[model samples]
Target: MTNAHHLQNNKPQDIAINDDWFDVLKISDYLFAISEPRHYEHTVVYLLLGSDRAILIDTGCGIGNLRRVVEQLTSFPITVVNTHTHLDHLGSNHQFSEIMMFDHPRSRDLSSNGASRDLLHWELHREELVIPPWPRDFHIAESALPPFKVSRWLKHDDVLEIADIRFRVLHTPGEAPDHMCLLDQTHRILFSGDILLNGPVWSHLDGGDVGELRDSYERLMRRVNEFDVVMPSHNTPCQNKDLLPLELAASNDVLSGKAQPQVGTDLWGRRYNKYDFGRISILSKYPQ
Candidate 1:
């Protein structure tokens, strides 16, 4: 569990992005981490190539044309599956025709609901930002996440065999109700969308449930020994597998009232209690 493998705070200074809007990191011959570091979200999408087809774990923020970049890398039939339909995760969903998603009300609602400028005001302000500027033609106010259709409805324990890789879907609902974690049994890698990350784990949204997340983490802890690495959606690309227990502990602390959280507000003006774990943080809305 050394710090050398993970990228902390979305600061990927070592990995060169080749002057593109997205920072591309070749995790392996079959896997790629496409990160949008310029935006405050610091979202990272995984591009996985299998023998028969390719599966994109999540589409980055729709600031740039991600489909074109993905086309440049592989010619395999691409199936875009969302970890969760957050503005940042599925912004570019319209760009692809074939998409797989969880059969949930939120996922269905988000499909037609375009991106909200109100929710994205923090990045739109672009003042005192750490990352670089947006694309030349990019305008935040005018931009909207276009609606797209989901091709397939993914369920828990569904086995997806792409080329040589076999992924088992785990229904993990903490960050979002329909959040999923794809376990690549062949490679021993976990594609954790917003379920896990190196930075603050946001569980303060409308349907974000800390109790549900605590249960999910406990389930994940049971299989922690199976995965070698965790690829989260934001901030970091590769995280040590040992961090799984820490996440479980963080969730437990929140449930048991062991970790005292400080009151804070997120960028979206949502009131929440920020719980700080040693390696990571969790932002959860105080129960009403």
Candidate 2:
């Protein structure tokens, strides 16, 4: 694993952000997001500078001149990664023939959650749905696009060194069963996918299990000391890595039946509301 010699000794720095047409964050040798504008959509993309080539985390929604935005950055051999199959995480998937995701059985299906389907034609800037139930159709043109190489599926504790940027992958199951977070040990940064957002936690209970989310959070906290900075896919850059513990305290309040479903601003400058359907149901099952 070759580390970029220049990014060393970064003592907890607020990621350099620029709002020049595109929302950006310079995290070490990688870039967090170039901007994706949907409230629930994540605009996180990473420009991993590698020894030989480079890799991008997720393609910004192919819309909004992302093609032009990336070109302004670098022109290395770019490989795209979708934290999962959510439409927001895969807007520009069709743009790249060589993309990858968790090789789970469900990975083959290009469909997404109900909310995502509510965003069909969103990439085309045509989110107008005449019918009340029509908007729940947002997702990729799975059939229209080319086949992807589901060659690599990371497991917990797996380390991926791409674009010369090293990441310790944590298989976080909630939000998306195949979601993974990236960690930069040198700076103790945790590239929390959609798992640790700074806003209201989405209790997407439909197929999501709250118990599992609780477990994942515990696992994440166990390793919180491993990372001092957390770079979430959405919202603002990591301000303090200690937020992990703070979040844990809040979560415990909810888990212990002390708090109600809360809506608040989370990491990444964006505000989020995590009151997904299954939230109440999951919380009800807890011994609280």
Candidate 3:
């Protein structure tokens, strides 16, 4: 198995060689993170190869050619799944033939219109240079979420077996109503989409719920012992299991008013309280 880092170090011509568009990180011989480090979102999509098939988690911001990048990774039959219907996460959904997601109305709506440039502008404005700057000749207005249909609907507890690895689907809603996390029983690793991350967990967005997110965190805490590593869909590729508890604590603090919240506004001009914990932060609207 070639180390993903080593594989990433050598960029082949077949792949989209936009130096600024994507950063491919190999987690294992069969697992890789296709990250957009240059973008403000630092969006990441994962590719997991099994003996028989492969899976892609989240398609990433549609600023570059993601399909070409994945083609460079493996030739196995690939199945795409989105953690939620958020534009940044599902931006490249149109590039794939088969897409599986939770049975959700918002998911349907997002997949239909392609995320609006109106909303994507908010993210583009936050761009910061990490390694590469934005792609040359790239304009924020030119990017739009491409519309695609869900090939299948995945239910909670649906077990996806790709060769020797078995992943159990976990319905983790808080960030988005249709949010999901995958638990790999083979590796004891949790593919925690946007539910948990080192960055600000946005529960202030439409269809987000602070109370429900707290409940979701509590549920994950109970099953914390089951997974060893937590892989999120943003900024960083992997995080320690201990980070879960810290995030849970932050959520609890927000719910209980234990920590003071600083006023902050979201991209849409809506005011929300931002609670910053050392390891993670929670941005949520005060409960109605």
Candidate 4:
């Protein structure tokens, strides 16, 4: 992965938030990577600015005031877009009003009912996973994700025009049924959700399908040349496009049974076969 070209310190000193819970890295004049580095998930959300509006792609774990941090960054109207409805990604969705999500049953269910407290127990209670100095207002025991209304349901290939910039939505399910990636052809960037990350990609969860995950990688590989940089949602923020083929190869190996996997258990105590591939790994359910 190449080093991120962060904005200069003098660029906008007034926009910087004094909070330590979130690490905001300026990737470009119009893009910012907002992340919760203190948590185990290291969930990274992105903010893309345009002439008329700004798009916040996925809200990181609701451990802090993301809305306040975002409001300090841009003055344009904001739109929240969930790459998928995973709790870690949409934790702060309720904090935003103009929200957009991919039209899927899982997305609808989670959006309406909200995630239960049980779903967050692993992250909240795991003392070993948390770093020191959590946000003063964040109560681990009482924190729970709230339901948010989706203002628009997006479809595959739909073009989102935020004034001068545009993002083409690609429905790339596998990490979740509602998983999607945004492709900015003009900017040469791919906002890959959980599908392609620097660490282990989980396809062993309840709503995930290893087979479908492999297919999604194949679909992205077909148009790999379209984007030069990959802005993943977890672990690393900005990565070279070279990581795409590596992930695709790992997915293919897992499906073909050519890769040997080690047994592992998640926070929920469900067993999964973890296939390690150096920088990237694939976690899938054991074959019956």
Candidate 5:
């Protein structure tokens, strides 16, 4: 509410989504994400109030102009993070100057290209993009959000203390080694990054691992009783207070064995399928 530009100007058109809290079309005070018809048109970055300041998860491709949108929303310093360093997620990193990344071999090892080539292709063509992403730039671009810095490298079990909130980092590697989830026990909310341990949730086809993903899902399910809401970086959030238990149960079965997957669908008409594979071989079986 303290942001200098609040209500003073209009938010960027490309990055704005209709607010859907309680189904009311009001601008969400907690977070806002813009979508381009690319990268599966995955929702990017969740803005929320922390114990101390505002926190932003995954700066979707700079194409969405996420920083500009957040700038008008809050005066608090934004803590930029990532689900993983794929182009769609990390496009806006260079803008903040000091962005944060988890300390994992895949995350830390940025030898020029910054992101691994294989993962880059996968996150992009997860069955062709829908978000209408910006024109491809061959050269890797650093953050362009500006007026900030990037100096946070999170670790497993690490805790982040913002102005008044505390977030526990769970290094649940699946989509990428640097992947993590933020547990806000106080609010019973888990900001699930790519560690979305669910039906076909693991993208083993894109540098994802079956074994690590299973472990991540298992770890989360064991702690499911502690949280009530899952605000995933992509896809719709599950605010059902009683849904965690169901998600947890299904998660356990998937970890120990394969699921029949009675039926499931992602927001974008993405249908789920069933599959079986060894552990690095973890992959999704999507219905074409």
Candidate 6:
């Protein structure tokens, strides 16, 4: 519940990329948060540096040159680890040579087919959804997410070590079936994907299950003491571990029918019942 604004307000002096599309914030000397503030999702990707290599968490909505921005951050041969195959998270996966993904059918399908202009047409054309001063080279009419090859497919409890740093891949599927969270227990940081964010958690989307989301939150709660901070993929970057209980209680209330929800509709016109819980909310399919 601590003010997360300090993560963004304290800018690092060593950032080399001076682009308008991406905002890079230094969480620590070894970790950085790369975010897309212009987009509605306000998606964030993480960069973790070790002694010999570096890991780049989810890539943002491919609006700008994420690979270029990452290159300036570290020169340790970046490896892209996608928390999920959602279009917003994997847009820049093609830009990286080595890509890691969860072993799931949905992840394979999206990575192979990529996101077409038609699929992203609504999001790209929405002027109000995007903040002004868009990227100079990006053209909404011609934009399309390119497919990237998955160098390796990982599973639950898989531990990845990059020199000195280690991340345990925890399969916490809810937001997406392939969604996974990277737990750096040594540093007490959890790179929570779309599962836990600052805004609404969409369990109404295709392949999203509210029950599974509740289970995932419950699982994280069991080991709440393991992590000190959560680096979420949307809205804010750093969140205290105390957020786990709040989200869990919200999900529990919704499932038990103890909470009343408001009708909500997305950009695609899909209807959902939204349960608001202040800093975070849950969007579930109606009649659930």
Clashing pairs in 4: none
lDDT of each candidate versus the true structure: 0.79, 0.54, 0.78, 0.84, 0.54, 0.83
lDDT of 2 by residue, 1-288 (tens): 333233334433334333333555555545444655453354566665556666666665444444555656667666666676555566666566456676565666662322243344443234341112212333334323333455466667877766546667677765667676667664456767666665534445233445566677787887876766666666554545555565555556555656565344433223333333231212222211
Clashing pairs in 6: none
Ranking by TM-score: 6, 4, 1, 3, 2, 5
Specify the highest-TM-score model's number: 6
Q: Quote the RMSD, in angstroms, for model 2.
A: 7.5
lDDT tens per residue, model 4, 1-288: 221233322142223677868888877778889988888888999998877889999998888889988988888889998999878889889899999999999999988998888776565435566787768877888888878899999998899876677778999987788999998766768899998889989888878887888888888887787787788999978887788889888988988989999999986678899999999998998652
Best by lDDT: 4
lDDT of 1 by residue, 1-288 (tens): 122223222343334443467778877667788888777788899888777788998887778778877887788988988898777888788888889888788888878675566654453334444365667666766766767888888898898876678778889998888898988877778888887788788899888888989888877887886677889999978887766788888888888989899998876668999999866988899653
Over 4 Å off, model 2: 1-21, 27-32, 37-42, 111-119, 122-147, 262-288
Better of 1 and 2 by TM-score: 1
Query: What would the TM-score be for candidate 1 when compared with the true structure?
Result: 0.88
Question: Which parts of model 3 have CA positions greater than 4 angstroms off?
Answer: 1-19, 120-133, 136-142, 286-288
Off by over 4 Å in 1: 1-19, 113-132
Q: Count the backbone clashes (under 3 Å) in each candidate.
A: 2, 23, 2, 0, 32, 0
What is candidate 5's TM-score against the reference?
A: 0.66
Considering TM-score, which of the candidate structures 3 and 4 is the better prediction for this target?
A: 4
